[model samples]
Structure formats: structure tokens, C-alpha cells
Target chain A: MKPRGWKELNPGAVITEAGSARKFKTGSWRSFKPVWIEENCIQCMMCWIYCPDMAITAKDGKRGEFNYYFCKGCGICALECPGKKGKKAIVMEEEGQ
Target chain B: MSASRVVAVTGNESVAEALRQVNPDVSAAYPITPATDIMQRFTHYVSNGKVKTEMILVESEHSAMSACIGASAAGGRVMTATSSQGLALMWEELFIASGYRLPIVMSLVNRALSAPINIHCDHSDGMGARDCGWIQLWSENAQEAYDNTIQAFRIAENMDIRLPAMVCMDGFIISHSIERMEYLDDDAVRNYVGDFKQLYPLLDIAHPVSYGPLILSDYYMEYKRAHAEVMSKVKHVVLDAASEFERISGRKYGLFEDYRLDDAEIGLVVLNSAAGTSKDVVDAFRDRGIKAGLLKPRLFRPFPYEEVGEALKHLKAVCVLDRADASGASYGPLFMEIASSVSPYSPRPVLLNKIYGLGGRDYLPGHAESVLSELAEVAATGKVRTFKEYIGVRE
Candidate 1:
């Protein structure tokens, strides 16, 4: 007399395999990580403010840092940095796991 | 595509900057308001080697789409951008690209369609191309616009769903407005979006496959029917890409985002920039003792019907707002859609249509407040229109 759950859900109704276009991911899995530069940090918060997902956060400015958990390793912060700070400051490199 | 930093720039620059970072193999685009400069920026990226992609400034949006089709067919990661009439012109081929199942991504700078010929923000342009078999995503602002373009590649390239996508942002408004957009790095975006792999290509001589083949009486309907079903299947892939993008970009780019809808008894549905305006209005009404909320549809195609329909059962009334007009119809494109989807349900909300801001008329916070007020007024009276109400039209 128990209610039906996902265990009893019909597999016929669920889409198991879609079209061939999206069967699997085609790109490399190991992407970049953005590391903030404290010296060039003006506290303008462009890195945090500009972050689409708020991956860059508001720290006490105890040296620069960015939240990489939600960070897609988008180098926008590094590219948009006003200074000539390259990978050395906001480095977007593959995390060695 | 390589460099990384925050700098001042407009929406056009934001798009160009984002695409440069994505670095498509071939960017075939025509000059159109707001979106023109993005293509121009790509030219500079090509020249400077910042983006190692080929730039082809085409004569027309039609040719631009065709060129993109060609590149995508050739197993190349291709991109193009357009607005308003340009999108309308690409209507026929739009279906072709999708039917062929090419995962080419394009940026549709949303604009009002013509008769009087106005070039400004509205869902008019993108709405018309809604069912073109492409994955349609409407962005709220320049940051969403920049991020959506990059996200489109991921959604399209996804092997489970081989279809093109239109990463739309309202023309001029988001396309021209200056904003601080977080640009994703090539490596990160590459990981998020992956690359274009043509599962069915016409160019591979060793493993040849026909694209855009003429379907006859025996299999035409079957092919078309399968196409729609394929799109439905791709829905999961879209969500997969969404989760991955959010993981990397730290943004919530989902099919729908609810604004205080959990305990609400009424719902307001909107798309594009209007959702932002509506959210503010919804907040004001909530302050004044109204149980109202907003539902913004991010993806148009593969219409998230079941998800939305089930969500609407709790509401007493619903307001469906569309930036485009489907003349002589009971409601605008969106209004009719929501109504039909909720038909079989017994306790469906009183759906009404508010067709506003055509030809890029200003959509202020007050308009949204007024809309909420009207819906409130209707529920109080137990009466709602089956026709469209043209808001902001002085005449």
C-alpha cells in the first residue's frame, strides 16, 4: 500500500538516450583556475562584481583570493584586469587533482 | 581570448570579448545594430592573434547563417550573430540547420520587428524565431549576454542534443549598455562547452553523411516528428550543460527562476529583460500585502511545458507577458502557449495576456506594477481577458 516512487517509475517514459549530437562531452575536462592578484586589487570588486555566478567573493582584502568551487575557470577576470597582470596574478591553470 | 582582466566596456565589447575567448573556428556575421561591433571586435581579435579564429564579414544575415551552416557542416565550430530582420531572414535556413542537427551557436540581439522599422529592445525578434528547432536562451543583461554566448556552445555541442542555439539578449539595451562582465578563460570555457563534433557530417569523405536531404512522402512526416522528439530528449542535455556552466561560471542559467513564488497564490510569467523589471515590481507589491511572484523562462524552445504547468496549479491567476505580438490571436505567443499547456488541468490559473513594449517602448518598473495591479484587479473581479492588452501604446 506504499506510494510509488522513482523505483517504480516507468523507464519507458524516461528519455534514456537523446540524439547523437549530445551523447558525450567532447572537450578537455581539466580546465583553468583563477587566482587573484592582491597588489593590483583596487577593491573595485570588478572580479567579484563582474563574476556571472558570484564565484569571486568579498574578502577582508587579507591578500587576494577567489572562490573556485563555482568558478568555471573563466579567465574574464584576468582578461578584464586593468593592469598588465598576466597568469602570475590571476592564474587560470588546471588544478592538479 | 588569452588575456584576462576586468576593464570598462559596452555590451557589444562584452560579447566580442566573450566570443574571442571562446575562439570559434569561423565567425560569420553581418553588421546589425548592437551586434555589429561584436563582429568587428572579432576582426581585431583575428588580426592581433588574441583569438585564433577566422572572421568572415558576410554580406547579409542570410549568407552569414549559410556560411555558418557550411562551416558547421565541415565539422568546424562555427558562430554568427544577428538582430531583428536579420533573424527573420534566416527563418527558412534556421530550420534547415536544426533538421540537419548542426550544433552551431549564434547570438540573437533581441530587437523589435518592423513595419515602422524600429531598432531597439524587445523579445519581438527572438520570439518570432522561437520554434526554429534551435536551443533559444534569452539573457537578462550584458553579463548574462556575455556568459550565455559562451554557454550556448556547451549546450549545442552536447552529443545528446545536436542542435543550434540562439543566445539572445535585447538589442541595443544589453547589446550596447556598458557593464562589467566576467569573461571565462579559453581553457575553462573549453572545458565547460567542449568542442563541436559533427556526429552526422556531410564533409567527412571517408564516412559521408547527407545533410539537408530532401525528405519525401515516405519519411517526411516521420523525420519532422522525430525532430521534435529529439528536441525533447535534448532538454536533459540542456540542463546538463546548465549545471556544468553554473559549476564553472558561478551563475544560475536555468530554464526558469522563481522570484518569491514558493508561497504565492498568483504568478507572473515573463522573459528577457522584463523579468528584471517585474522582479522589482513583485517586491513592491509583496511589501503592500500581495502574494505575487514572477516566473522567468530562460529557454524558449523545447518549451518547458510540464515544469511550468505543474508550477502554475497553485496560482489563482497568471499574467503572461510577451514582447512580441501575434496579431488576432487570443494572446501573444507566450500567452497562448501557457494557456494551452495548462488546459487539461482542472484548477488552472486565470491566464491573461499583457502585450507591451512593442517597437522598443520603454518598459519601466511602473509598467510591471501596473500589470500586477491589473491581475490583482482581475482576480478580485473573477474576470480576465482572452485578448491581448497593448500596454504603453499612447494611441
Candidate 2:
């Protein structure tokens, strides 16, 4: 839909709906993406707690999946992952690879 | 036909009395000199349980306005007050409050901006915020201050003009000086102001809304245009409110007051308390058959251009007395507005600017007399010795 002009806006130009930010795919901003492996995942939830975009989600009694729709691929989750013996549970991969 | 009583009160107390009667849902306040009396008196009403207003005692003027904005956005009737520096501190949030279209009413006890730290009456504070999108009302005395404060709510919350408003009274002079004023009964005030109808309250989760969003090149201008459109509609709302208020209080009001301007050859345009002094001088000039008149603007914003232009167009000469300095401009702020308002006319009046009473200096009747005399000379000669003059300044 074509956006309305400034003169068409009501006062304050308030965004009316809740959680409308989800409709915007910020993943397009990512040049590299994080690939997760389940074997080395300890489910410490550090990635879940520290993810700025709340991209990492957790389920009961297990590690969760990354909702990349909102993530910008900052690699914070991969960098904070504590896999044993220097093995990273999450690693960055080039987009479209 | 609301029952009313006459009371002796200072301008600050008068504003407080009006606020108490309106009894807004929320009031956020930080005290400053001259303006401090307003919040102080209002606080007493809060403590005594005379009103149900949630009084938020903020640490600074910025927080005072910020809290008022939040409360207002939350669908509560909100208000606050401040003076020179306090108004300056709230400068940023002033735009935010108005841009959000929150109907917040503020009492700005006009004071001079500090360089040497003066706390006296001047137009510097109010004039500085003239473009901040708030409807501005200047009061000539305690009675007008009380009346304007009550009218501000109706003007600000009018459906077509939901912008914040500021009712300004001269600091120290009007704010502290005691004067006789007639006040409407509480029920009358409440009924006149009516209930505050909030547009998009944040607490309305059923229909959630996001305020103060980041709109870039796609729609920033549109939001500003919408704000401007609402402001342009303020004049009619102000007049309607005044007319209704007159019905209840029996005191008439207008965009500006014309005192003996009809068939006058010379006129003086001024604002606030100085207008009172100018009126006395105008009467004196009239007795001498000088045909001098005075035009005092009650509403400064949504400036009554056509009204002002037409009023002055017939005059041979007009002098604008501005209490605030426009610093380096050929004329002061009021003069600039008058100049532009009448600019389209083909044989405009020989307008002159006089900067007077800066930093609370005395604006005596003699000083006004001097300006009127000068105006008469300019009218007779059809030429001005100077475009602008600093009145009462030591040579």
C-alpha cells in the first residue's frame, strides 16, 4: 500500500497497533547469520538473556531456536556461547551461502 | 448565571484558585520565584483534600512538564507552572507536549531571562516560546489572569484544537501584587471547562497506541503539518471559549482589546500590564484631542492578523511597545508580528518600535506618554526619527 502523505496524518502520528514491529523484517540488515548446533548446547540461557533483539527463544527442558526475523546478526549469542574445549555451539555463516 | 464572589488575591493566588476549581486530574510542579506561589498555593489545596488532583512534586521544571505530558497522555487532565529559568529548562519538553497534542495547561509567570540573574517581569520567557506550538495568552491583571487560566482548559482541550496552552502573567508585578478579582463558583468553573476528553490515552490497552515514534523522511513533515493545522484552528476555539466564559462571568473578551482606536490618528500597541498604563495615557491624549488609541492583544498565538491589520490600517501612525528585546532585530518581537500582520496593506501605518521595561524596569504612565507624544510627531511629519527606540534607557 502506498504510504499517506504528512498532511494526511492525525496529530502525533501515533502508531496504533501493538507488536507491529514484528512485521518489519530486520534480518535483512544481517550480512552474516548465526548457525546453531544442538549437541554442544548446554542451555545456559546466556544467549537468551543477553540477546539485544530477544531473537533467541527457549522452550521448557531444552535449548530454544533463534527467531532470525528480528535479529540483526550481531554475533553476541555465538560469542557468549560456552561450548567445552573451545567448540562454539553457535557460529557465524555468510548469508546466501 | 453562576454565582460568583469577589476576592482580593495576587495573580499567583488567582491562578491557583482557578486551578483548584478546575481540579485537573494531575498537576506536576517545581517551584521557582514569583511562579512559586502558584504551585505552593495549589499544593495546599491538594493536602487539604479540597481537590482530587494527583500532585507530583518534581525536582526540576523539565521533570514537571515531562510528568504532566505522561499523565496527560495517560488520559488525565494535567497542568503545571514555572517562571523564567524554569520555563527555559522545560523548553525541550514544551515542543514534545504540544507535538503530542496533549491538552496540558501551564501558568508561565513571565520573567526576564538571566544574564545578571534578574527575577523581574518581562516578555522574554513567554516570547521565547512563542513558536513552540502552544496557544499563548497574556494577562493584563489578576482578574484577567484568573479568567484566562480557567479558559485555557477549554481552549486546549477543544476537539479541533487539542494543543497545550500557556497563560502568562508578569512575574513579581502581577504574580505578587494583590488585586481585587471576581471568581466563578467551583461548579460553574467545572461545568464551563467541562470534562477533559483525551484523544489517545496510553493506558487504553484495548486500543493500544505508540506515541513519540521515530518517523523519518517518509512522514515527519506530515506530523508537523498536522500539528500546524490544529494550531491554525485555535483562534476560533479561543473565541468560543471566551464567549461562553463571558456568559457565565459577565466579562467580555476578544483576541485583542481596542481602547478608543476608532477614528484615532495615532495608536500604541502593547501587551500585558503595560497596556493598562498605556490606556491611561491614551485617555489623557484623547482629552487633549490627540486622537490616541491603544491595542492590547490578549491572545498572542494564532495571532489575529486580519483583526490586527484592519485595526491599525486606518491609523496614521502606530508604535509597538515590546517589553522583551529581540536583540539585533530592527524591531522587537511584538513589533515584528505587527509589521508582518499589516505588511500586505498598501499605505501601511507609519509603524515604530519601542523596547521598554526590560528586566522588570518600571513602565510608568509618563513613559507611555512620551511614546504617544513621539507617535503624534511621527504622524504629523509623516516620518520617523528612528525606526526603533530604547525607552527609559540611561544615556
Candidate 3:
């Protein structure tokens, strides 16, 4: 969005709209992305429960891919995956790789 | 004029009287010297049921100001009082209150800052917070203090100028001294300030508005610029409020009080109680054909620069006496502002700065007379021996 001038800004910078945080894309803040390995996935829903930003999308008793629009990848999903050794359900990778 | 009762009261008591008339919805304050009596008296009103204000006794000035911000955001008329260290402690929250455009009125009993640890009157406290974005109304005596405190509510709460305001009175000088002043009728004050209305009240669940949101570089400057623009409108709002107040109280007010400055060769600019002292001295100088005058600034914060400049432009020379020093700075806070006000005019008055009366030092008529004598010399010779000096200091 284009920057607004003083005349165009709201009084006292008050944001009149509720839940406006959804408009801001914070995914760019992440340097690492968590990649899900579907073959090793137990669908235990650990990542969905642990995602601080609510970035891990989930369905009825099932999990979906990371919602990068809101994800600020902290690698907590890969750390808490509980998948054994090299066959981990989630792993971290550099972005744009 | 509306019915008013004449009574002798201290500055703190007068301000408390105004508060009783205002009967703010909430008050949260932690006391400091010279200012404690104001809140103490206010709490008495609360206990005796003279006012229906909710008193929130806080642990510190910071918490007090924070609570005031909360209450003000919740669409309540809020007030508090403090001095010196108490004001310094509330520094960060002061900005937040004004940034949110809360019309919280505060009684700032001007006192000296600590370190040397003096408990006395000084401009250091109010001058320190001069740029905190709140409107400042300085008083010369107990009467002015009372009047200003009453007017502050109307000025700050005006829809076009919903900014917090601080009514400043000298610490021990005026706060403790008893003087005769009139108290406007309770109903008269109520009608004057009128009912409080808030635009996006936090208490209103029907329409929610986010306050104090984090606006990044994309819009931070615009928000600040808007804030600045609003301050530019304060001077007009203050005059409007003052005129309305005059109809009810029969007392005139202006951005700054001009005492015989109309046709003067030399003048003096001072603030708070010192202005009262200098007024008498100006009268004495005038009697002797010195053509002296004085300008006492009442609405100091969006300082009426153009008005001040126009008022003093005709004088040959002018001296700005400050009650506190700016320490490492070249001149006192008031002096810098007065200098800036007259900077645009051609063939301007010869300006001088005087730092005096720190830690409640006596601002005697002799001190004022000496400063006027110096100004007289400068006006005569069109030269200044010293641009700035400390007056009433021991050699």
C-alpha cells in the first residue's frame, strides 16, 4: 500500500478496523521454512498445537501444509515433530532454496 | 457573571476546589512534595461524597498515569496531580496519554528536580516535560491557578483539541500560600465543561477501535505529523474556551497576559509566580518613565509565537527571566522559546536571558528591577554587555 500523508491519516493513529493484523504478511520475516515429509507423518497434530502464529493449517483430525502467508518460521514444528532420526515428519530448510 | 463565592485558599486547595467542581470520573495519583496536598484534599471530597470520582491509589506515578490512560480510554473524565520527581517518573506514559488524545487534566505543581535534593518551587519540572505533547497552562498566583485548572478541562476536552493538559503552578510559592480567589458555582462549572463525549470509546463493545497501534515506518511519520497539526489548532481552541469561560466568570484570558506592553521601550517575559513579582516592578519602572512592560505566558505549549512576537516587536529591548536553567544549554528553556518567537521580525527587540529562582529562591522585586535596569541600558545603547546571566546569585 502507498504511504499516506498527514491529512490522510487517522486521528491519533487509531485503527478502526478489528482483526486488521490479518492484513499484514509476516511470512517475509522468516529465513527458514519447515518442510513436511508426508511419508513419515503420523498426523499427531503436534505442529498445529505448537505453532505460535497459528500458521499450521489443520482440518478435522488431519493436518495440512504450512500457511506461509502468516508463518514466521521458527522451526518449532520440525523440533517438536517427534518423528525418529532422519525420517523426521518435518524438517527445516533455507527459504527460496 | 455567574454567582461565585470569594474565599481565601491555598493554590493546592484552589485546584482541589476546581476538581471538586469538575468531579472527574476517575483519579489515580501518587503524591510528591508540594503537589500532595492537592490529591489529599481531592480524596477528602471523594470520602465525604462531595464528588462521585473513583479514586485509584497507585504505587507509583507511572502506574498512576497508566491508570489514568486506561480510565480515559474507557470514556471517563480523568485527572491527577504530581510534582517534580513524580512528573519525571510519569515521563513515558505522558507521551502515551497525549498520543492517544486523552483529555486528562493534570495539576503539575512545579518543583525542583532532585540530586541536590531541594524541596522548593522551580520551573525545572514543567520545563522538563515541555515537549511531552500535553497542553501547558502556567499560573502566576493562586487565583490564576484555580482559574486555569477550571479552564483546562474545557480546553483539553474540546472535540477539535482532545489533548491532555497540565495546569502548572509554582511549587511552594503558590501551592502553599493562601490567597483570595473566587470559586465558580458548582453547577456553573458543570455547564461550562459540559458532558464528556468520546469518539471510539474502549468501553463501547458495539464498535471496537484499536488504540496505540504499531505503525511502522510506512505511516509513523504521518501519524506524528498529524499530531503536530492538531497541536497547531490548540491556541485557537484555548482562546475559544477562554472566551466562553469569561462569559461565566467575568475574568479575561489570553494566550499570554500582556501587562502594559502596548507602547513600551523595554519589556520582560517571565512565567508562573515570578510574573506576578515582575508586574509590580514594571509598574514601578513605568512610574519613573522607563516605559517598561511585561508579558506572562499562560498557554505555554503550542506557544503563541506569532502573538508573542507581535506583542514585543515594538519594544527596544526585552529580558526573559527563567526560574530554571537548561544546564548545558546556552540559555534557559523560556528564553529559547521567546527568542524563537521574535526571530522572524526585522529590527527585532534586543533579547536577553536571565536564569533565576532555582530551588525556590526568592524572586524579589529588586531582582526584577535590576533586570529592567539592564534592559533599559541595552535599549538606550542598542548594545548588550551580556546576552545571558544568572540573577540573584551570590558573587
Give the top-scoring candidate (lDDT).
3
Deviating ranges (above 4 Å) for candidate 1? A1-97, B1-8, B385-387
RMSD of each: 24.0, 1.9, 1.6
DockQ category of candidate 3: medium
Q: Sorted by DockQ, highest first, which candidate order results?
A: 3, 2, 1
What TM-score does each of the candidates earn?
0.77, 0.95, 0.96
Ranking according to TM-score, highest score first: 3, 2, 1
Deviation in Å, model 1, residue B178 alpha carbon: 1.7
Put down candidate 1 lDDT per residue, A1-97, tens digits, no spaces.
Answer: 4634323422112222334323322223327767676665656555665666546667585335565556667678777666444323465666674
**Pick by TM-score: which candidate is best?**
3
Give model 1's DockQ, 2 decimals.
0.01
- Can you write out model 2's per-residue Cα lDDT over B1-395, one digit (the tens) per residue? 78899899999999999999999999999999889999999999999999999999989999999999999999999999999999999999999998888999999999999887999999999999999989999999999999999999999999887989999999988999999989899999999999887899899989999888877787777788877778778889988999999999999999999999989999999999999888998999999989999999999997888889998898989999999988787779999999998899988899999899999999999998888998899999887899888998999
C-alpha lDDT of residue A52 in model 2: 87
Residues B3-70, candidate 1, lDDT per residue (tens digit)? Answer: 34565677778878778878888878888875777788778889999877777777888889998988
Per-candidate interface DockQ score:
0.01, 0.70, 0.75
Off by over 4 Å in 3: A42-44, A83-88
lDDT of each: 0.75, 0.91, 0.92
